[model samples]
Target: MKPPDGPDFSARWAALRNIPPFLRMVWQASPALTLAMIALRLARAMVPVAMLWLAKLIIDEVVVLSQSGGPATLAGWWDSGLADTLLVLVALELALAVAQDLLGRAVSYTDALLQEKLVIDISIRLMDHAAGLDLASFEDASFQDRLDRARRQTMGRIPLLGQVMQQMQDVLTVASFAVGLILYNPWLVALLALALIPSLMGEMHFNARTYALNHARAADRRERDYLRMIAATAETAKEVKIFGLSPWLRDRYLTLARRFYEENRAIQRRQLTVMAALTALGTLAYYAAFLWIIARTLTGTLTIGDLTFLSGSFLRLRGLMEGLLSGFSRMAGEAMYLDDLFDFFTARPRIASPERPLPVPQPIRQGFRFEGVGFRYPGREAWAIRGMDLELGAGETVALVGENGAGKTTIVKLLARLYDPDEGRITLDGRDLRDYDLDQLRATVGVIFQDFVRYAVTAAENIAIGRIEERDDRPRIVTAAERALADQVIAKLPQGYDQMVGKRFARGLDLSGGEWQKLAIARAYMRDAQLLVLDEPTAALDARAEYEIFQRFRDLTQGRTALLISHRFSSVRMADRIIVLENGRVQDQGSHAELLSRPGRYRELFELQAQGYR
Candidate 1:
């Protein structure tokens, strides 16, 4: 479903509701820093009014001294003690100025620290929440967009913390100015509000429009970023160059970027036009109030100090009001983004361990059984695997063979419970797979898919990820590497197990596809799980290497249940049983020699590959 073009009016105000929770997050990030920021800002908020009042007093005193005709010379005035009050007042003003600067710096320092803490806190939360979601959630396009927005919010919404605090500070400052203005004339304060109200409304409307534009373009922005990455990244560089795709990618990025720029420019243009006119109205009101102040002074109805204070107060109040209004609107817009972050947190995994989950059984009894299982990927119409009955008996080595899109990988995912079957049930030792603790069940099964991640870390670290809890166990890492025959590949590297093995980082060594496959295979061994799955684990290796790897695999997994997926008939020929899948169902199951002896899809595929070898 398409997201709304933008939030509506009520939605904009409702977004404000997010601020309280957002502040709570900020407070949680660092309570001491949060409190320090508030205190510093509150202290700074009163500085402006105090300084202005002092200026008024100084001016009034100077006027009185000049009119009194005290002394002819500065020395004479000072000796007579007439200039004493002026001297003390000036010194006090200077002190206040210094305090203001120090407080401003303190607030700035505190804000910076608080913002960093909030970013880290929010980023960690986003990572943890994303990790807990079901694998299917990551596959959905809509979910991807939401995830993207939420990820952006980790850094993007951080400024809202400072903005909120500043808004509060501005509120206190505005209240102080308003009190002084009301003392002179309540109508002046009312007039200022009337003038600024239009400007505030204009700001709100435009900020809402800006937010809507960005929200609608989230998917486009993601695609643009992807294009940007593929055009320049090491992984895609070879393919991009070979295909001569630079122009296409550049044009696509430019198209999306241009649209974003144009939409932003349009909103900015309208905001400029409307806000400028409203701001001019506010200027007129300030001048009108200035005229009234001067008239009162001329009539002797107000003292010179009153005129000075009232005029300065009016000007400051106008600027403060404008800032408060605009800042509030911007904060509201930012609060809308908070919805994305909080909404992401609200997403709970559909596949979770049951309450009072049973511990996963050790030393398998009946092994795994899929009874009339049916499954489909999220947002997909056709089933990936349906009405399938399969089993991996204890101590049995089984292989799954199929054409492309024939659900070989789907079977592995279902066995690992990356996704739950939509129909029927999958059981382990007569108990439903869902009945066991999710983490424990996964820990019991080790799987290495064809597209395993080539991490930009030391070779040992890459293997250690399989059972991260045992990352520090050097002996285990080495043993796993030897079992997968990855030790031979690592031995050639200058730093052996410690060498970083990806082109993504500098001072890193890139490995060949087969070598990387060897490293990936080591991860499975590192797990030492009860049920092992190698899905196209040797795809990048030659026939000779593939045969050697499987030869060792069969020996290492002799008494453990293993499921293998491979297109190479040579690799599966040694398995105790081979299951052939067609569409989403098992078509046949037998020993390789038995299948080859029969006239079936399995035999046809075997002959086709064998002819290639011949």
Candidate 2:
């Protein structure tokens, strides 16, 4: 599956303006709630502006009262009627202040709730799409980067959108002040508009550069994070010390961090230089206005009270300029980041599962056949398995033996339908494999690969994951554990079947490598499939454990077609038929006694392993 090539950010940003579905969702989910929240925020903001204006009114009223014609005493200023006006303003101010606090908490809580909902929605959708994609798509580095960016941004998108509301309210405050200025002098209103330019440009330039660093260093960041985990994680600590790999992984992490720091330093330098220019522009305008305002008062055209009001309003206007400038740039950058998230959210898998899937009949009568099959890995020149002709009949036990890097696993993957064969076909009961439902085909084949997943879950849950839709039968889970000879391992644990099998969690018990391998085997046994494939499934088991597993393997595979791959001849010898694979083709195949009689690749491997036992 091909990933989207080279994101056109400009095109994507333009597309964000057409926020039909996303905005519609917010509206539909809680239109009244959203509007109520916005109204509360706007009401909260007006309180601050009113408080600032009321301050001036109080000062002006005091001046007028001081100049009144009637004979006045100190007692008059403290009179009940005069005190009541002051008290009402103070009371209103306190009420508005509490309203501000309440609104802050409410909006923060609502934003968090919405942001979580959005992340879950995006994560689930991405997981669904990721599931639909063929395994080959994960090979693309660009695809992984897209996934990472989408996930991170989705977590924070709503908070950023909420802040955009903050910027709008601030802008409205600036407009209200400017409209007041318009009554006094239209020239002051125009100057207020002109003041926002320098800061906006500076802010936009800095944020874009910061995001560029984040984009360029995505892989290195993840590597550094993994290195940290390995250094700190409990299970890895012992191995890390034994291998003397801590210093190496730490050095690798430091290298990535140093590179990130250098990029960050460069960005800081650029930001500081831009900010200096912006600061100089604001200083020039502010000083020139200060001198002009002083001259107006000295020449008797402007009263001290008028200057006081203008000065206070201009101070508010200046804060608004800074707020709007920074806020708008932040919003634009966040919107661009959101575009990346939205792009990924909307990424349809390159492979669309057919809406009407063809049926794969159960009981798998004759078994699967690989006919003239061939496969080459992605971005590779040579074939991993070329023209591989293989077959397995129902109720047959077939063993595949091969040297390292031989095509045995590749053939297994093809049979599992993890990858589509480049040429020719695999058939089930003489019907083309593609004609069968993908899920149904997988459900019919139970596979345990060489590198099986050691899920960090409870022992019961781990075994039950082999066939998750089976309702996690504890009795069946216990039976599978006994058949794989994992009973002793589970019994020693603190919580038995309920015990978590990874050191990542608190109170979780760790397992030996052999123990994990047995658990993996038991997990595979939970699947009631027509075919069972085990690839190097007991590499961690001791000689005795290996012998016992093969003794039980016959019982586990009774009446089912089974395929196994193993290096140990003690286990391989039990197979009814053995097939040895070389570089990309079959070298020799027969019963163990017959293959031993032939003195071929299989015989040489058997002797080599038997020598190791000595």
Candidate 3:
């Protein structure tokens, strides 16, 4: 799908609508910090005007002292107390300067702490929300693009917090300066506004264009990140070297990054050109105001003190107004990113449990049954499974034999409720699967697919992840490991069960394919699940090892319902009933011997394997 176009002028202003919600998240992160920051900023905001006003007072007092007849020497004036007022003014200005420094430090410290808290809070919310979403959402290309944008916002939008606070503080400072400016002549304030309005509009337009460019490039950025990962990561390093993929990966990354840079550069160039011209207009307006102040002083209509005050206020106000306008435009652009985060949170999972859910059956008496079930993955026209009917009788060991894409793994996924069927119903015992509490239903089943993760954690922790609540139950962990023959693998490690596995981290030892397979299988045994599904679980193991593992599996899971998927006919022959699947439907089913005696797909496949052995 084509990426959505960038926000227009109206949309940029509309993005400010996100500010309130974003502020609420900031407040939610830490109320004390938010309140502290605001209070400190308010105090700091008034400092500049107070300091400027004091400078005018000190100047006026010094002028009076210099012109009036008084003690000629410094000691004579100090002794006579004639310079007391000027000294007091100087002292007050000194205190204000010191106070400003202290307040500035306090604001920085508070802002730093608050930024960290906000980042942690937003990150946690993102992880929790993503966890509750449907698995299909992660698989969709557009959804992934949105997710990438939202994830970037977690860190990328943090500065918006300080930017917003700074903008607010600057507005208050500008208001104080404007009050003084208005007393002299309101037209000076009007002229400043007239000059800056164009600049503000220009800034807002360019910021919106920049946001639009980033929004459209989310996919390219994600691909670039992926390329960077594959080029150097531990998992891909070996293949990268052997396949000579470094140059190709580097070129692809540069290609994407260069396009992004060019697009961004174009927007920045236009902004620089337009904004520089507008800024020159503002500078001209400031000098015009200065000339008016000098003329008033020369005419004796304004005091020298008044001249100093008016000119200083005008300069500070101009800079503050410029900063306020530009900062606001940037904040609005950043606020646009908050839409990605809020939009992600707004996504609701379609496959969640009902409000009132039945408890999953303890013993799973009748096991699971799929009734004319049909399902297709998101963005695909071809159904992964269609009109599929199957049954797993309680306490029976069923073996499914099928080539890739014959719906073997899809059936396992359906049984686990990772997805609901697009068309028909699935049931546990006599009740609809959807009627059962989703979590409870999943807790009752244990599945170990062929491509299980090799976690970068201790051997024991890796196995414990299957049923994490029992992680501390050492005996159970050990027993499960021994049952899967992973105990032998762990025993060879430097720290035994505590040994960190996977080469992803330092001081970690990697395992062979067969050894990793054993560890993965151990996770299935860690669960106290009634129904166990093993999909090509022994593919990494040698023939003798596979036979030994399955022998132990059948012995350990004697009364539990089990479903096994494998291409090796030798393994399926041990199942009480073997199912042959073709084109997403069950083609044949019977005892291994029964199927082999007949001229069917099962017999044909067995003969092909047998011929390979011959």
Candidate 4:
């Protein structure tokens, strides 16, 4: 695959602008913890400069005491106390060391807590945003890449908060040390600034390159993650073992991973070389300043205390400058990654309810009518369904029959407003479906597709997802399950309603395909929707189960609208009417008996199916 293009310089700068908002989000995660962290950092920030100044004092005091003929023995020194200034300085240094250790621990503790809260906040927001997106967005590969990058930011960029806080603390310490150096000789400050300029620019350049590389490789990273999941997860374990796919999957993973490694290695190699050269230049400037300080002391132009303070400050200033510069680059890179997160959050769902949505007509009087509807999936040439006109009346049972990919499921999708028709409108009671409140619309139309998710939760909770607020209503759950014929299956479980239904969790009771299908069908009944749809959800059921379920489907869906999509003519024959679809257009429509007597696609298909029994 071709490598994706990297973000331009303008894009990188735009990403940087997201920092303030990102920091605001972090702070908002936990106000008290965030405040505590800031306060602790401020205190810790001044400690380094204070400790260095105190060291200078203690060194000078020792020299003065020795020259003044202080007590020789330890006991005499303690008793006479002539070395009191030295003793006091020594004690103060020890106290400063102890204070620094305590403040450091507090800052770390606060940071860890803040990180935890921020992760939770980001994860929740990510899930909520993803939930609001249109189904089409999830189907788009580019959107998936963006989502993958956004997901990584929740946990991967966590240390960014601490890094920024530390950078702030270091800035203050550098300023404090710089002031002391300036009082001695301002030229030294200038020399130190000049030395770090090269290194700072180098770091920024390399950081930008790294961000570009990561941005370009988003799709590749997503593929690698998918491959890894397929190789390791229980969901694919059966097929993987039967086909002996382990080696092939491993090799494919290695090929993709190695490509990423090679790209990253090239960037790292250049960064290493540039950083080394810059470090040598900084070291040269440091020693040059060191010699000048010694020359000033030798010529009687400076005292020992002044020399010690200036040299110590100069040494510290260089290290701090280097740290501050390097830290700024790392922070910029992290902020760039936040672009993905903020971008995902800011994405507007195209299928959202209108601002002034019309209330969904209760009892759905006129039912749903598709008027010359046409739809094409994104990036596709052929329409999934086109020029289709159909009506599903209230209290009617309609079966949509067709070959695979004959737009059977697409019609169901359009009815549920999962995807609006591209070329025409679908209206309910003479009002466009788009005018109805989206949530209310979905709630009124319950659909169970062939590929319905088999949740790994408890049996009761799984069915309860249909009407989540009524999950605690045991009577309602039991009623729905009984209607779907899943009650008998669940009643035999070791824990019954409380039993976990998938193999994902420990001690979970795995059910057969038919049993799982029955459980899924219950969710639709649980909804008690005005319009209930089953799109081949019972294909896994045995012949007897399928026949029995459809025989009672009308009573199960009494006084409501129903649309069933199935290839089994035996099941299709139970509907009040059957519509045959071919090549994204309806070919025929009638009762099963009427269709059997006609010379058309429906008659052809019905006869073909009947031949299997003969």
Could you estimate the TM-score for every candidate?
Answer: 0.97, 0.88, 0.97, 0.96
Cα lDDT tens digits, model 2, 94-153, are 776787788788877766665565556656766776777766767777777777777776
- Predicted structure with the largest lDDT when compared to the true one: 1
Q: In candidate 1, what are the lDDT values of residues 15-82, reduced to their tens digit? A: 99998888889889999998899999999999889888999899999999999989999999989999
Candidate 2 has a TM-score of 0.88
- Give a tens-digit lDDT track for model 4, residues 1-614: 33334455456556668778878998789989988988998899888888888888987787787787877888898899777778888888899899999999999899998999999999999999899989989999999999999999999889888888899899889999989988888988898888888887787777777777788888978888889999988889999999999999999999999988887788778779999999898899999999999999999898787788888888989999989988887787788888888888888888879999988888888899889999999889899999999899988999999999899999988888888899989999999999999999999999999999999999998899889999999899999899999999999999989999899889788898888888898999999999999999989986668878776777789789998888888777888999899989988899999999979988888789889888
RMSD of 4: 2.0
Local accuracy of candidate 3 as per-residue lDDT tens digits, 202-316: 8888877778778878888889999988899988888999999999999999998887777777777777898999899999999999999999999999888898899999999
User: Which portions of model 4 miss their true places by more than 4 Å?
Assistant: 1-14, 73-81
Reference-based lDDT, each prediction: 0.91, 0.75, 0.90, 0.87
Lowest lDDT 10-mer window, candidate 4? 1-10
What 10-residue stretch in candidate 3 is worst by lDDT?
1-10
